[model samples]
Target: MVTFLAIFTAFLIGFLITPVLILVLKRLNLIDAPGGRKIHNGFIPSMGGISFVVGAIISVLTWFSMSQLIEIRFLLTAFGLMFLLGLRDDMVDISAWQKIGGQLIAACIVVVFGDIRFSSMYGFLGIYEIPDAVSYGISIFTIIALTNSFNLIDGLDGLAGSVSVVTFLFLGWWFMQAGMIGFSMFAFILVGGVISFLVFNWHPAKIFMGDTGSLSLGFALAVMTILFVDSNGNMNDYEGWKFSAPIASGIALLIIPIYDTCRIFTKRTMKGKSPLAADKSHIHHFMMRMGLRHDQVTITIVLINSFFIGMMFIGSNLNDHVLIPIIAVMAVILGLRLDVITLSRVKKIHRETPPILSLRERKKKASKPNVNKEILEKVNLTQN
Candidate 1:
């Protein structure tokens, strides 16, 4: 019930706060023009996620306590870095390398202070053991990759926030179920802010998250992910928190970004292009090619992300090692197949449509193409 209220509050407050947020962002000179790969026609504020973050802080603090707040230094650090970086990018241009540097710093902060990382699996790999050194290396790499995945998925308006809010809500429930209270409340606060921000971001957005909102949300996920495994990792020296498959659970929580980022990088590498190169190759871009409007595409992808995360959450409960492996394999296969199918369609459209078609699609056809040629010749003669 409390969770539902939080969700509802996100929608209600986010809806209300958006306009004010937009005005404030504009007033502060944080505007995004719909140029480059962006298809919008006018200037829109790109820092509304800042407002969402603020609103989330307000909501969570109101419902949760300061005690919980003090314990999450890692989360705070990650969010702070994201917010600053996002804000910096929102206002002025920042190099991709600079953002990457910040993400590394944020990940280190979480790993060192927040103590979030995976140590070992419950037994999916038939090895219930892990080395401390290996764990640190793997966990750090995972955190940085996941953080950037969030940014990569932030290509469409409202899409990033909606996916994030849903992901956090699920993780919050999971954390609470796993007996991690501080992190759960922390998740709720961030969830609230993103949800609220999405109210205006639904479609024809007055503002976009830009890198500011998206990066912060992704970093927040990294924090929860660490907490999700902390009990099994470094939180205690007990057998109470043992997972046969931490990697599986962690991957499920972050299925969308992790998968999407890998796919993007692989394709970019194949094309002799920089992996970080931005083009219309994302899943949402395919959604557009599939003739989905912006709102429809955003909603569809958000729902798909929710579905994958939901499946991961449910699949995590099965104690059968065989069942977990089978489920994981099948899920990944289906996900990859769908990605390939979608990308094929996008690539087809790219091949078929001339670059000039964009203006052609938008232009008003004069008098319906004059289809009646013979009558048209007479009409033309009359006109002449």
Candidate 2:
């Protein structure tokens, strides 16, 4: 009952605050403009993340005690840093290096101060334990990677937020079953905040989460994932809470963003482009090209994510060697098929509408205004 109240309070706060934030952003001319590579048609406020952040924080403080606050202070501090970084980027474009540096620093804080580093492999690849140095390295890398992966997946309207909502719901359920009420409450609080944000972020979005929301969310998820894996490994000896394959289960839960990021980065590198170079090659973009509307694409991806989570539950008794391989193969096959479809569509479009001139020449022609011979003649006569 207390958990229910927390969730509802968070949701109410987000739902109530978003419209006002939207108005404030508009008044300040803080909007994301639609143009090349963007799908939206008009300017939409990009700082909608602020509303949910406020809502989630308030809900968390109301439910948590002073001791709980001290225990998770590092994690909360990291989240705050991410939020600020994202807010700055949304207001004024920051360089890629700067954003990455900020992520690294935040990740380090979580590992060093929050004491959330992975201490073992959980018997994956026959390795039960690892050195502290190696553990910190891997933990920091995972946090940075997961954080950026979430940001990368925030392309379409409601896509990122919807995926996150599904993820938090599953995480919350699992944590509750494992008797980790604190983590469970945190996950549900996030779900509440995101749900309210999604109310305005659906199909025709009224506002975008921008960097603030995505970065903060990604950071939060990273922390949660590490804690979940660590706790499950430590409790594996227990009867009711043993997760037979924690590593594999974690990967399965985050398969969509992780897989999509890897695939896109590989494609970009193959084309001799920087892996971070923005383009319309994400799976969501491919789905859009395949005639799926924004809402349809969001819903489809959410369902696919849920399906993978269900797979994790079904295969919980299997060894990592068996379950991880199966999941990896299935994910790879799906990615390849999507790539092929997207490539085929691109080739067909090129074949049907062959370019009449080079890109530079086309640009020149487009820039010049058209004047018919009769119009020119009339102008000449009038001048004479």
Candidate 3:
């Protein structure tokens, strides 16, 4: 079908373009160096997001018409702006406020121009219809917050791309079932791009998506979420496929990133630190401290997200008021448990590994003398 072809085209383009981008990024020395919050070794090419973003754009344009789908233009426009902002930040790191300002502008374009704002809360706490101004504000906040949430989770190899693939797959299938072909196409197209990128972005990753992929893809996911909530809210009870707790269901799909971001922000604020200050307080970081490998942590988080999505489907009969609270409680419990267990593991590791030995191990891990000189030369070619 046309949909499958679009996905295939995007996949093929991403699969082909990623290696070239990796080569170019390394040649240009546009690589992420491991230090501080970064847990990787040596240097790895970044901004590899360009490959998949271009692939998705080309694939969408090849099959979708602007005239027929006017909103698609606005969506793509906002997407491009987010991508550019992220690409710029990746090249020469931008201040946090500047990045947020860019996200705000992109969010405004989608909400004000594309009219993708949430119209209702679907009876969560007896709130049905929202005021226009309130709706716009909430929608814009949601978009920007979710955009950063996804970006924040891009800490581990394959984490962001894997989460994205899971989100889009669910959204695409749901959109198709909801009779929204355009939305389904949009989701599936990006799904292909991210999946292909995962080929080079898995454990021992050769490349990172950087902000380029995270911001744009996260923005797109936010847009789809708004659409999903709005469309589901308007559905009648006669529609057998309609979920009673659309808002909660959408939250379930994004619980991992959203919950993690909110928790980290709160923890930082309570400790009198800037919420945006980069640290290892993330759930993934804690999991890693608990001795989980990169791939294992990524898969575990993905499974956790899938579990929430499955719960949403099974609890379709529940209203947002009940289901949302339950989800929040569960998330809080899970986060607390993870933090407690990781702390114990960290203490155990400290006890097992003497401080002198730890320092030596850190030095050995940080310096990769065994790496091929030719490979280093190839990556640092432009330096000379």
Candidate 4:
């Protein structure tokens, strides 16, 4: 009941705050312009993330105690830093390195002050406990990787928000079953914010989450993922919430973003281009090119993500060593097939379209209107 109220409060706050934020952003002339590689039309406000941030923070502070506040002070501080960084990026574009540096700083805060580093590998690859240095390194890398993965998957309307809702809901349910009310509260609070934002960010979007939302959301998910792994690794006798392969389950839950990022990076590197260079090669873009509208693409991706989550549940009894490899292989195969299918479809489209004339040919053809008219008359007479 308390959990439901928390989610509702956050939702209501987000619902009420978004329109005002949109209006303010419009008045300030802070909007994302559509052109070249962008899918949206016209100028839409890009700071809708601020509403979710405000809503989630207000709900968290209202429900959590001072002790709980202290426990998560560093995480909150990191979130604030990420939000500010994203706002700055949205307002004035920042260099990729600058954004990465900010992410690194936020990740370090959580790892150091929050003490949320991964301490064990949960017996994957025949490794159980790792060195402290190694743990910190892995934790920092995982945080930054997952953070950017979420950012990269935020291309289409409602894709990021919808994917996030599914992830948090799954995590929230697991946390509740594990009797981890605090983490569950955090998950549902975030869910509420993202869900409310989705109302304005659906197809034919009036507002985009922009960097403000993506960065903050990425940071939050990264933190939650680390916590989820850490908590599950330590749980031995938890009846309703024990996983034989927590890391595999986490990977399954985030397969879409993780796999998509890897696919894009690999393709970019192979083409001798910077991985950060933006292009219309994202999975969502390919799906759109295959004739799926924005809403259809979003729904399809969400359902795919849910399917992976279900697979994880069904395979929960499997060993980590066995399950991780299967998931990885499946992801790679799926990505390869998507690329192949998209290319095939693109070729089919080109074949179906009329051939284009060169400039010289077009000019020469235009100069001979009498011959073209005669040909057209003959064709019309034949049709008659």
- lDDT string for model 2 (299-378, tens) is 98888889888888888888788888988998898778877886787677777774777767989999999989999999
- The TM-scores of all predictions, comma-separated, are 0.80, 0.88, 0.90, 0.90
Task: Write down the RMSD of all candidates, one decimal each.
Answer: 5.1, 5.1, 9.6, 5.1
lDDT of 2: 0.88
Give the lowest summed-lDDT range of ten residues in model 2: 234-243
How many backbone clashes can be found in candidate 2?
A: 0
lDDT for position 309 in model 2: 86
Ranked by lDDT from best down, the candidates are: 3, 2, 4, 1
**Candidates by TM-score, descending order:** 3, 4, 2, 1
In candidate 2 the C-alpha lDDT for residue 248 amounts to 80
Q: For model 4, how big is the CA root-mean-square deviation?
A: 5.1
- Judged by TM-score relative to the true structure, which candidate is superior, 1 or 2? 2
lDDT tens readout by residue for model 1, 1-384: 655565556556666777887888788887877768786658888877777776665555555556766776557757787789888887888887887788788877877666676656555557556787776777778777887887887877677877787788877776676676777767776776676676677787778887778878888887677667556433332434344345566666677787778777888999999997888777777667765688887777677667766565465445436545654576568667766777787788778877786657656575357487788789989999
**lDDT at 337, model 3:** 88
